[model samples]
Structure formats: structure tokens, C-alpha cells
Target: MILTGMIFQFNKDSGEGLIMSSKGATNEFSASNWIDTSCEPSVGLKVSFEGSDTLINIEVLKDESISIVSDNKKYSASDEQKMEEFSSVDEYIEHFKSLGYKLAKDTDDGKVRTASLRRFLEDGHGEMIITSIDSKITVKTMVNGKEVK
Candidate 1:
């Protein structure tokens, strides 16, 4: 789920903080939960994030307008994209699962199927979600929080 909030309080030394959501709920967060660590967060900074109950993704909001403060290459979701053909949906899932990714979500209709898998790579981490219509499948990948085509 996505939630918008401002930093309620942060202890930079300990890398821990609380986010005060618009709904008046406060949730604890950690620096380690940040996907884009280029800009260290400060108290009172408005942020929108998505994550499970324990983890948070601040980039889905940061990338929309806020300029990142990193000196490293700007992470664009579309950079270095590639396309590959898969013989079947099972083939696609097996390919990524074999590489140590775990299935995150899977759904199917009579005519279409979809699945998402994720892995924390040693050098770069990524999520792969594939959708299949009949025998044709399209795969989308996000590496180090940037999407690849």
C-alpha cells in the first residue's frame, strides 16, 4: 500500500524515524528501508511511500518531482532496457526462480496469467513481473529500483 507523510521524528545517528501519515497515523521506519539512499531524509520532509508493513519504498514518490541529491548517475527506470522472447509463462518463471528469485505474486485468468518475482542481487537488486496473454508473454524488470523494459 501507498502512504503519504512527513518525517515525524528522526534520529540520524541511529538511522531510525517515524512517519506521520495524512490520516494521522504514525509508523516507524528505518533508513535501511529506503530504496534511494542518495538523499538522507530530514524531519518534516514530505514524502510518499509504498512498502509492506515493515519495509518502505520512498522513490515512487521522490522520482516524480523531488530532485535527488545524489552525485552518482541519476536512476531512470527506462535505462538499458532489453526484450526477450519466452516460449511460455512457466519458462519465464523458471528462468528467474532458478536464479534465486522467489515468487512474490501470481494470478491467472482463463486467458491471461501474471506473476511477480524478486531477488536481492549481490551487485544490484531487482523485481521481475511477467504477464502472459495466451502464449505471448511480456516481462518487466526493475533493477536497483529502476525499471527496465
Candidate 2:
């Protein structure tokens, strides 16, 4: 869920903050260090941490179990990206499943119909969620690899 809050303190030395949530808990998160948002939090403008614990970007705080965004700098999506590198169907299923995607048995031509906890991206090449065509090449999926996605 998206957690919205007010910034109590911003420790520039650590890039972490003491955030007082609307729901009533102070969360300490590494802001500039762990996640760099286009809109930096200014004391009490209100902020959100959606889906995951790491506040990689400033997401709209909403009343939902999950949140969506086009892209964010902090969370690397290469880890969820998959191109058909299957020796066989089982291998393909297992590999993508490892990446949190489930093969659509009914739509079994070779596209990820749904993913459990994954959002696939190609950085600049393309997007993975929009295709069912089996591709032989794919970008490496890395999260916080210290390399720009």
C-alpha cells in the first residue's frame, strides 16, 4: 500500500529521514542515498512509499494494495525483464517464474500474461509486458547494480 507522510527530519549526512506517517508511525528511510526522487520531500509536502519498503521514487499516496508508475530511478527493472531464452518450455517457465512471472497456460504461445510481484522493463530497448513474441535477446535484469538502468 502507499504510505503518505510528513518529513520530520532530513539527515543530509545519511540521506535518510524521519517520516511521520498519516497512519501514525515514523519510518526511517535512506532518501537521497537509496532513492532519488525527482520531487524531493520538503519537510511537510507529503510523501509516499508504494509497494516496497524502499522509497525509490515519490509515488502518489493512494488507498490501494499496489501502486503503478511508468518508471523510477531507484528500482531497477532489469531483474524482472525476460526474453525467450528457453531451451524448452519448462526452462522458460522456470526462468521467468524465478523473475516473478507466471506463464499463461491458457495463452501459452509465449508471453507473460501476468506477473506476481514483478514489473518488467528494458531501460531503453523496449518494454517486456507488452509482448508475447518470443525473443532471443534480452537485457540483463539487475537491481541496484550500481549501474544506471
Q: Per-residue lDDT tens digits of candidate 2, residues 18-84?
A: 6544433456767653342446655443456643455555543433422343232233344444256
Q: Report the error of model 2 at residue 135, Å.
A: 76
How displaced is residue 96 in candidate 2, in Å? Answer: 51
Error of 1 at 54 (Å): 13
Among these predictions, the greatest lDDT belongs to: 1
The deviation in Å at residue 33 for candidate 1 is 14
What are the clashing pairs of model 2? 78-141, 79-141
- What is the lDDT for 63 in model 1? 49
Error of 1 at 140 (Å): 0.9
